[model samples]
Target: MAMDRELVTCTKGDGFWTRRILCTIRRLVRLSAKSSTVGNMAVLILSISCIDGNLLNAFYHAAPSSEIIRQSSMNSTISSVIFKDYDVTVMLFHSAYLVDIEQTEKGRVMKLDSLKNGDIWKTMDVLVFNSWLWWYRRGPKQPWDYLQYRSKIVKDMDRMFAYKMALRTWTRWVNSQVNATSTKIFFQGISPSHYNGSEWNEPGVTNCLREEQPVDGSTYPGGKPMAATVLRSALAPVRNKVQLLDITLLSQLRKDAHPSRYNGFKSMDCTHWCVPGLPDIWNQLLFASLFS
Candidate 1:
C-alpha cells in the first residue's frame, strides 16, 4: 500500500476528499515506489468532544479547564493493523481548525482572532490543510449569528478580512505550537468553485451543468479571484514554514471538472469535484509533493 507497511484511519469529521486521499495513499506509494511513513507517532491526536462555545468565559469557568490537556506526544485510535497486513499506520483526523467563540449580550458569536480548539496538533511528520469555503457561508449555512473580532461582536464584516483573521489565528499556532524541525507543513491553495458561469467568461452559463469543455488556455479568462490574494497574504508570515500547493490557477481552468449534477446525485454540486477525475490530479500533486 502507500506505507512501507500499513495505514490506519480515524476521524472526527467528514471529508469525502480526505477519505479519498487515504484510499489512494497506497497507490501513491506504489507509483512512487517509495514509502513516506516516519517513525512511530505516539498519539495521532484528533478529537470529537464538547467545548464551551464561549472562550472569553473559559478562564472564569473551571469546567472548561480541560483545554489544559495533558500535553502528551499525541493520541492514537488504532486497535489492529488498519490495513490488516501492511506496515504503516496513518491516522486521519480531518478537523476544521475551530476559531474561538464568545457569548455576547445579543447572542453567540464566532471569534476570528483566536482559536479555542486545535491543541491536538501533535508532533507529526506531515500536515496538510485546506480552508476557505466556510468563510463564504451565510444565512442558515453560517453557524454563528455574529462575528467577534478585536473583542467586539458585530452582525457581520468583510469576509476577506474575517478570513485573514481566522487564518492568522491558525498560522500563528503553527508557528508557535508545532515542532517545525520534525514536521513538514502543506497548505492546499484555494480550491475554486464553479457556482458562477461568468467566472469562466460565459455570463449566461450560470453553472457547471452541461459543461463539456475545459477553458482553453493555461490562464483562465475570468482571472484570479480576490480570495487567492487574501489567502496568500495570510500565509506570507510562514512562507518558508508552509509549502502552498497553488492549484488555484490550474483548477480555475477546469470548470468542467466539478461534479455539476454528479450523475443525478446532487442536482447541483459545483463546489465539490468528481472522483477519478480532478481529485485524482490533486492526489498526484499531493503524492509528488509528499515524496519531493
Candidate 2:
C-alpha cells in the first residue's frame, strides 16, 4: 500500500540541534543581532515542529477551534520558552490558519479572502512559519468541512488552491504587518514523505521501512512536488519580506530517515520523520537562515 496522508506523532528531537538553535538564538535574537535587543527580543514560531518533546501544532489529530489553551491536559511551559542566559521569549503556536471562519446556513466556512488571524503574527521580532503537510486532509481528518472563497461557500476546493489561498493570506499579512526594518520572517517549504518508492527511483520498494541509506546523489529522482511549485509561486509577492527555507529538495533525498516500521506497532508511520534525525538538519538550516 501507499501512505495516503501523513501520520503526525509526538516524537521529539535529541536536543543537539535544538540546543544549538537556542545558543545561536541568543546571539541573533534581534533582527540585526544587536546585543542591546537580544535579551528582550521576542520570536513567534508558527509551525508543526517540535521542541522539548512537544508538537507545535500536531494537526492531523487537532480538534477544530484548537486555538484555546487547555491549561490542564498539556504543559504550559511548552507554549513559551526562555533560556538561562538568553532572556528572549519565544512563543510557538500550532497555527496554520491565518483567516476567519463563519457559521453559515452552509455549515462552518473558512473565509479565504480574509486574514482575520493576522494578529497572531503582528509585532514579533522574528516570525518563523510552516504551513504544509496538513493541506492533504480529508474525511474525518480534515479540519474544515467548508471553505468560503470569493463570497461562495465551497464544500471542498482543490487542495492546492486552498493551500495557495491560505499562504496568500499569510504572506499578505507578513507584507502588511511585518516590517523588514524591525521583524525578520521565514517560511518553511513543503515537507515530503517517503510513502512511495517510485518517488525516489526505487520502483520495487513500497515504503521507507527497513531502509538504511539515503538516495545516492544530490538530485532527487522524483524531481519537485507540485506543492513545492505552488509554495514558491504563492510567496513570490512577499518574497522580499519573508525568507523561504526550501527544505523539500534536500529532504526528498532522505527516504531512509522516516520512522517507518521502527517497530511493528507503528510500522506504517512514514509521514513523519524519526527523532534525533532529519529534524536536526531542518533546524540547522532554519538557524542558518536566521543568522543570514
Candidate 3:
C-alpha cells in the first residue's frame, strides 16, 4: 500500500491526487472491514496516509477585503473542498510579500530583492495566485485622486501603490518557479460584485449568502464588464503561462450562495460560500482542467 501511494504521488503529481487515491482506498477498506474495530483501523490508516503524503504545494491566495472580511459563502466552500488536508499553505490576504526565498518551504515575508538568491524559486510545485476582489470591494478610486479608509483609518496612494507593487513582485517571483510540469499555476478571475442596485445587480442584498440557497442561474448585475477588463490588463502578460480560473460568471449566477444564505455566517453575508457547494465546483473544474 505504501509503494502504491508513492507511485500515485509520483504519477499523479502529489497532494490532491494522492488524497483522491487514498480516499478511494479508504472506502474500499471500509467496505472490506469485518467489524467496527476494523472500520476504526481503516480510518486510522486513512489519516496516516494523508499525513505522510509527499505532495508539498503552495497556494498564495489573494482577494479583496470584502471576500475575506465578509467571508463569501462560495470562497469558504471552495477553500474547504479543494484545500482540505492538502499539502498547501494558503497565505490568504489582500496583499503580502515573499521576503526571503531561500528558506526551503518556509520563506519569510520581506522585500522582493531579499529572494534574489533563494531556492523558493525552484522548490514550489504549484502556484495559485490572485488579486482583484480588493479593488472591487473598495469600489473605485478617482481618476486623479484616490482614497482608502478603513472606517476612521485612512491611507493615501503611497501605501496603496506600495501594496500593489509588493504583490506584483511576489507574483512575478512565483512565476519564476522551476519545472513547469511539476508546477501547475492558477489564478482566480474577477468575481463580480452586486452592490450597484441595478435590476440584474439586485440592490439591497446586504449579505446574500444563506443556508437555504437561492437559485443557481441568477447573475449579479453590472460589475464584471469593467472588472474583467481591469483584471485582464493586470494579468494578461502572464495569461499564457497561467491557468486563469474564471469563476465570476458562474458564481454571480448563484444568487443565494453568499455568506448569509449559503455560508456558515448568521448575517446575510455577501462574500464567502458554503464549503460543500462552490468550493466543490471549483475543485471539479480545477481537476478537469488539469486532466483535460
Please name the candidate that would achieve the greatest TM-score relative to the true structure.
Answer: 2
Per-residue lDDT of model 1, residues 65-98, tens digit only:
2222221124422111133222223434423434
Candidate 3 per-residue C-alpha lDDT over 1-292 given as tens digits, one digit per residue, 9 for 90 to 100: 6544434433332334435433433343344422234332221100001111212111112211122211224433212113233222222221212232122232222343334522532333334444544432332532112232222212334533434544455456656753444445666665544333352544564434332444334554444555555555556666666677778778766655544543234444555543334544554555455443
TM-score of each: 0.69, 0.79, 0.49
Q: lDDT per prediction?
A: 0.58, 0.65, 0.40
Count of steric clashes across candidates, in order: 10, 0, 29
Poorest stretch of ten by lDDT in candidate 3: 43-52
Tens digit per residue, CA lDDT, model 2, 190-270: 888887888877788788887889999899888899999998998999978888888898888888887787744655867
Query: In candidate 2, which residue ranges exceed 4 Å CA deviation?
Result: 1-16, 29-39, 50-78, 101-105, 263-267
Q: Specify the highest-lDDT model's number.
A: 2
Model 3 regions lying over 4 Å from their true place = 1-122, 132-154, 158-167, 174-181, 192-205, 209-220, 223-227, 261-266
lDDT of 3 at 140: 50
Error of 2 at 292 (Å): 2.2
